[model samples]
Target: MKLHFLGTCAGTEPMLDRKHASVAVECDKKLYWFDAGEGCSYTGHNMGLDLLDVKNIIISHTHMDHIGGLGNLLWNIRKLTQMRSELPHFDGVDVFIPNEDSKDGLLKLLSHTEENFCCDYENRFYGVQDGVLLDDGKVKVTAYHNTHLVRWETDKPLSYSYRIEAEGKSVVYSGDVGLYTDLDPVIGDGCDALLIETGHFGIDIAYDYIKDKNVKRVFFTHNGREIINDREGSLAKVARLFEGRGTICEDTLTVEL
Candidate 1:
């Protein structure tokens, strides 16, 4: 399996060579989208990822920076059907999102786009909750609630982190946690890799949080100013501290797990 980073920028203003927070896990030729930040499908397509093979799209939250390209992603997948004769083996794409309002709004917005957002393949939406969400034979995705969002009217969570187990390896996505410790339960004892988002925090805090943990690998993503503004310095610091156990992920980069 491999991990492809489509966008690595945070919610901040546009920066050089970065878009937003989006990542895709490729397993057995199928794609599992983690987030659909701005231009995610565009970047994935350009990176040689076949959007038709996208079996699932999971969103951490409904924030614009996190879901800005969700509609386009769906639209592009449908558009590709006209250019190709093949359909996914599943013949559909399942989306897991935490916010029902965002899903409704996206569908409404897509209705105004070309072809009235019609597609031969089914695009199903599932509400995210804290539990094992899906086991597709290729991968098992589990969701855990985080303190990224709170609601006074309901007990539903508006943000989540995902624990993905595939090929006997486990990976945890932080998904913009409110605190580093927020991932403790989801991470459990350890994981093969931690795709920790740095959009809301810095590398120092990230390092400090995981320094003594059993995490085998670390990939710093959703870059913030501290790392993006000083790539060389940050890379050097990570290399020195983590000693090859850490990496600073950039857009369009793919890594094997």
Candidate 2:
């Protein structure tokens, strides 16, 4: 499988080469989108990715930085199908959002657009929960609530971090956690790759949090003050700390896992 970083910026003003937060896992020619940050689909599609190939869109929270491009993503997919003579190869597109309101709000907004947002493909939405959310033939996605959202209820977890398992390999995505320890359950024993966020925590904090864990590779995304303020300095500091275990992710960067 391959992981594509569409946007790596956080909820800050525009940067040079970063957007917001989004990633896509490619398995069996199907794309599983995680977080639809601003211009995510645009960046991915322009990079030669087929928007129609997207099977699932997962959201960690309802923040604009995370879902800024969601409506555009759906619009672009429908536009692609209309432009082409053929329908989408996949049956439908499924979106998993942290709350029902997020999906409903997006649908309402889209419905107000052209042609009442009519489309040629079936797009389904699901509310995210803490459990196995998707079991595609090639990969299984498990969601565990994190402390990213302030409106989370103790009885019902709406925010999440994801553990993606495919081809005997696993990767954990920390979707803007409130704290690194919030990923303990999702992290579990270990993972081949950990797509962690550095928006809220520093390099040293991240190192300390995962020091005793069994993470093979760490790719930092959803960048924050440290990286945005001083890219070279942050990279150098992270390199000195994790040596070969860490990588500062960039927008539109693709990695094979």
User: All models: lDDT?
Assistant: 0.91, 0.90
What lDDT is reached at residue 133 by model 2? Answer: 94
TM per prediction? 0.97, 0.96
Candidate 2: residue pairs that collide: none
Who wins the lDDT comparison? 1
Model 1: which residue pairs collide? none
Q: Ten consecutive residues with minimal summed lDDT in candidate 1?
A: 82-91
Whole-model lDDT for model 1 versus the true structure?
A: 0.91
lDDT tens readout by residue for model 2, 194-225? 99999999888999998889999999999999
**Every candidate's CA RMSD:** 1.3, 1.4
Model 2 alpha-carbon drift over 4 Å, by segment: 150-155
